[model samples]
Target: MNLTLKIWRQKGPQDKGKMVEYKVTDISEHMSFLEMMDVLNEQLTNKGGEPVAFDHDCREGICGMCSMYINGEAHGPDRGVTTCQLHMRMFKDGDTITIEPFRAKAFPVIKDLVVDRSSFDRIQQAGGFISVNTSGNTQDANAIPIDKHAADEAMDAATCIGCGACVASCKNSSAMLFVGAKVSQYALLPQGQIEATDRVKNMVAQMDLEGFGNCTNTGACEVECPKGISLENIARMNREFFSASIKG
Candidate 1:
């Protein structure tokens, strides 16, 4: 298949960026989006031109490193999949796919299709760690059996890979979905109860400090999240936050 790609080109964070166009031919429908990108890069290299720069670690979608805004949608036109998991068949021949990095004040572009996502790291770091009873008097981990439903939900929440799709998809650039998933993963389980109050407070504080916008209940984050992280997690996080606020 032949396609035209209008990709953002930026030399550095401080450099002015613009959309640059190119053409690719004979792309297989089975090729994962990243593979198609590799083909584009190869073509550029063969012509002595700088190739597009995008992030991808573990193309299997486990890492969530392949962040791209394709044709105005986070992770392209697919549902419940990361950019690396997107396939060429999602589009057709003679298609013009516009690709850019995830855009948010918190996610500034570092270069072409690569953004500074260390902000997410800082938000996560602000959550700190869960308290564990490692003392000699510790009970067996399996002794305090968690409810099956809560445990399952907690595990689901833990599936979040820290991808910024929530932020990118939000009109307000809110990260509530991501933060909600992080908080809920622990909030649902007994092991996470000890630091629940501080966990929610500190993480929310850090989220605000990072310049991420507030959630307006638009539900765009859940719609774009590759992991299918639910909006219910956001509601649970709000409850956790309010409860923490009340206690203090």
Candidate 2:
């Protein structure tokens, strides 16, 4: 198949960027989106031109590194899948694809199709872990029994891979879905209860400090999230935040 790709090109974070067009031919429908990109990069290199720069690792879609805004949709036209999992068959010959990095004030572009997502790391660092003393006499987590329903929900929330699609899809650029998932993963379980109050407050504070916008309940983030993280998690987080505030 032949296709035209208009990809965002920026030499660096401070460099002026624009959409640059290129054409690729004979792309197989079975090729994953990143494979098609590899083909394009090869063509560009053969012509002594700089290739497009995009992020990808563990192309099986586990890493969430293959984040892309394709034709105005996060992770392209697919549902419940990352860009690396997107296949060529989703489009046809003569298709014009517009590819860009996830856009948000918190997710500043570093180069073509790549953004500095260390902001996510910083947010996670704020308070995304359980402080368990696993030293000498520490009890194993299995010793505690948990309700099956709560465990299931917590597992669902933990599926979040920290991909910024939630932020990219939000008109307000909110990180609530991502933050909600992180908070809920622990809020549902007993192990996470010890620091529950502090965890919610600190994570929310860091989220606001990172320039992410407030959630307007538009629910675009859930629609675009590759992991199917539910909006219910946001509601749970709001409750958690309120309860934590009340206690203090």
- Score every model by TM-score: 0.97, 0.98
Stretches off by above 4 angstroms in model 2 are: none
Model 2, span 1-248: residue lDDT tens: 99999999999999989999999999999999999999999999999999999999999868878898999999999999999999999999999999989999999999999998888888889999998677888997789999999999999999999889999999999999999999999999999999999999999999999999999999999999999999999999999999999999
Residue pairs with clashing backbones, model 1? none
Candidate 1, residues 59-107, lDDT tens digits: the string is 9989989899999999999999999999999999999999989999999
lDDT of 2 at 239: 100
* Superposition TM-score, candidate 2 onto the true structure: 0.98
- Tell me the lDDT of candidate 2: 0.94
Best by TM-score: 2
